[model samples]
Target: MQPGFDDPVFDSQGVFRSVMFATAYPGRIQTLESPSTAPTPLSRAAAALCLTLADIDTPLWLDEATASSEVIAYLHFHCGARILREPGVAVRFAVLSDLGAMPPLSFFHPGDDAYPDRSTTLVVEVQSLTEGPKRRWTGPGIRGTLEIGIAGMPESFWSDWDLNRELYPRGVDVVFTCDRSVLGLPRTIKVES
Candidate 1:
């Protein structure tokens, strides 16, 4: 299998910081420059995220399109993350590649009010961040509102996101990845398309 992170410590830290910045400012796109490579169907940003965030204790879930043997092996070897087929509260991180067949957000862990940080963080593979329906985001990190277009999400995505928002502090957070670009959409943000 291929190795992960050219400089495991520094590279992972850099990726982690980029992810944090994205999470803090929803609708913002952050570029990642990881030296690691992932198997087919998984973008460099997504693979970098898995390597930076997942560990022996983390449970990761991969959607049908991202569960290739090579991808699984890479994650296992580099991240030591447990990959499960089922979507449940036990899942800490999820990688989604096929949006058309994406399951409802309710299927993944939402974490309880007391443990919201334990909820699943979704890493979605998309076509482009600069194309698609424009959506306005307003919430904690934005000055007022931020409008951004994200391509390749399913038709039900916004509706599901709305429902997820209704859950308030219990829903999942999303990170969109395309090539080496990444965008964040934390549950704390309000989205209007």
Candidate 2:
């Protein structure tokens, strides 16, 4: 597999900015220009994110169903990331193919009191990104409230999120990808469903 960035140095930085902006302003949608390409089940934007954020030492977990040998080889060749077969271990990042079919919130590492920043970060693929539904977002980065709607996620997601939120600074951060757009849902953000 080849890198999607025409200029690795600048492109990675660009993607990083996109990621930062999305995470900084939770509930806001950001677009990725020249998103990297990936195998089916993984969006171009997601592939770009994996390339930009993950590296040789990053312990990453891919959805078992979507991680074909070729896909794994691509990531290894490009990012040199270590694949974590055991989800129980402390992994830095987890690539998910379908947000609607995600695992139990507790299945991932939420770090410990000593280092909450060590929690896993989920890179999820969703069906659509919209801000039309009657959902409100309020938290550290948000000013007053932000209304956003992410289509194709199971209602159980919010219920699961509620439990995840209870973990406070010890929960996994989430990044949602759909086509050429990406959105971040840091643990600090609260979803008022």
Candidate 3:
């Protein structure tokens, strides 16, 4: 089993705050010096997120790339979270090693109208993250508009997101993790080029 937050209380709180900040200020990159450790292809930021948000009650689903025994053991030991085989199941959180290779975005659970907040939250690892190939984000969290760039995404990801955006509160939320940085793209964030 791998080590989790050095100081469980403080570390979880810190990471939680950063995740909240990321969602509150969508498209803004947020960094947290995570005290969590995970298997390869998983970022520290994402590991921290798993430790912070996942618990016995929240079912966690991992992509094939990260469904290894080692990684599963790590998540189990640290978060005591359950892992499910299906992404479309009512999982509270899902972890994917490569966003570019993932299945259709809509394949995951999108909460229904009466319980939109029950949708899944995706934590994806990307090859790199930088600012360029600009995109405009406008939504509840943005003051007006925010321009940002992200790399290592699949070519059709933007189009998929466009369709997901149309679903309003019913779509899954996303968190892109790369190295030590984390960026959020909640269901409320609308993206444009």
Candidate 4:
């Protein structure tokens, strides 16, 4: 809807709305439709995120293995965002093709006292998403709240998240993208074992 790009099948506005809803209702599953065929690891959920959040202002960092010219070109063509190499530098968005080898989530921006919203967001693509071992989640967006399970996450992630959560208003947020669906894990959410 901005201009010049070919029309997309899914309503861009609707996609954004669903993203907001998912963020507002953490742990909720949200499905999205992608107009064009995306490469493996880039699911409809990931595409929707790239389309909705990426813009001239956002800086994206792609995993080394997934950092192909085609991927970069497609992102630039569709989202008009800039690609960054370093994770520690200022970046609003990041995509992870191989979640297994991804750097520690703490490597990215975790914001600061004056600007808590400056933390980076990670879009992690996983093999599959399904209900797994049950885990307890509580915090903002959760209504006194819920218990759910997720598949394909490393145990170290939970350990790392414990540290991240302790940072409070200075931690980053994450989105898990699988197939055409996504799950939000806002920084405000606390994952308890």
Candidate 5:
């Protein structure tokens, strides 16, 4: 695919379909065909997410480190999403460049029982992604089951996740982006340690 300032011939509908499939089947590896060459701190998975979710209605809050002009321009051109600064505000999408330095997962809206889908969906960019030691995943999306060794996440992430999971249908969903791969951790999936 050609990488340029203009938006590539990305199929937003297809990307959304893939995202749905990924969320419906969490812990399963899914790939998105990105249009760009994949820049540092911006993996193909993150790029695909920006394309799929960010539209005129969705406001995106990017980490200070990753909030560059090039990134903003590209996202604007492709997704036409409005960029914001605060995490607790009305943004629907939040991108974290430094996974280690990210704010507690509790910072964003976790939605409510009446409108669970109204919560923010965070796209976390990490240095690497491997099965973590503390937790085991076995839910609707797993084939048999899988072990995930989370890397570069804050110590409080898992605990926060536990609380988020308790919210059931009213919690935020998450996507971990590394290199060219994406992993979904929807609110519906249960995580056991």
Candidate 6:
């Protein structure tokens, strides 16, 4: 089995902080330094996120391309996160290796009004965060608007994102990861292509 954080306590705390910062300030790119090594098909940033955010209490759903035995074993051995065989509203987190093939954002758990925080958080592996079609982001964290691009997104992504945003407090949050770089797109953010 692959090892997890060298210093589980400190490293997880650090990664958690970085994740919160990115989520708080949407469209901002956050780099994770010296993250734990993940097996093939699992980017280091995604693995680090799984380690930092998932635990015994969180059920993780891994999409087709990322559901390899190595990744399952790694996450299981390190974080004790239960890997679900199918996707459902109960899934607290999901990891998608191919954004183009991912299920609609609405397919995952979008926590209800009573418990909006119960929504699933998606960790998506992509080619580049700065090389795709640019989109403007405006929301809580962003001052006015922030323009950014992400490679490998499906053409229908922005449209789907619009629907997700319409859900307001009850929608899936996204974390885009490429290599060791991470970018958060919380449900509250509005994006225009």
Report lDDT per candidate: 0.89, 0.82, 0.84, 0.78, 0.76, 0.89
Q: 1-193, model 3: which lDDT tens digit per residue?
A: 6678889899889888888998888887889868556677678888888888998889899999888888888888888988999976569899988665788789888889999898888998876657447788999888999887787677687888988888986998999888778889988787888
Put down candidate 1 lDDT per residue, 70-144, tens digits, no spaces.
999999998898998897877889999998889989889999989988899999999999898888899988889
TM-score pick, better of 4 and 6: 6
Regarding TM-score, does 4 or 5 come out ahead? 4
For each candidate, C-alpha RMSD in Å?
1.0, 1.7, 1.5, 3.1, 2.7, 1.1
Winner on lDDT between 3 and 4 is 3
Task: Sort every candidate by TM-score, greatest first.
Answer: 1, 6, 3, 2, 4, 5
> lDDT per residue, candidate 5, 1-193, as tens digits?
2253234454556667777887888876677766556445577778778877887888899988778887887788766888988876488889988766788778898877788888999898876667446567876768766777667777688788888888887888898887767778887676777
TM-score of each: 0.97, 0.92, 0.93, 0.88, 0.87, 0.96
**Cα lDDT, model 3, residue 122:** 90
Ranking by lDDT: 1, 6, 3, 2, 4, 5
Clashing pairs for predicted structure model 4, backbone only: none
Q: Per-residue error at 116 for model 5, in Å?
A: 0.9
Candidate 2 residue-wise lDDT, 82-164, digit = tens: 88897765588899886556797788999899999889888988877783355788897889998888877777777878889
> What lDDT tens digits, residue by residue, belong to model 6 across residues 1-193?
7777888889888889999999999988999853567897988999899988888889899998899989998888888999997778779999999776888887888899999999999898999999998999999999999989999999787888999999987999999999998999999999988
> Model 3 Cα displacement at 148 (Å)?
1.4
Candidate 6, 144: how far from true, in Å? Answer: 1.1
* Model 1 CA deviation exceeding 4 Å by range: none
**Considering TM-score, which of the candidate structures 3 and 4 is the better prediction for this target?**
3
Reference-based lDDT, residue 83, model 5: 90
- Which parts of model 6 are misplaced by more than 4 Å? 34-36
Better of 2 and 4 by TM-score: 2
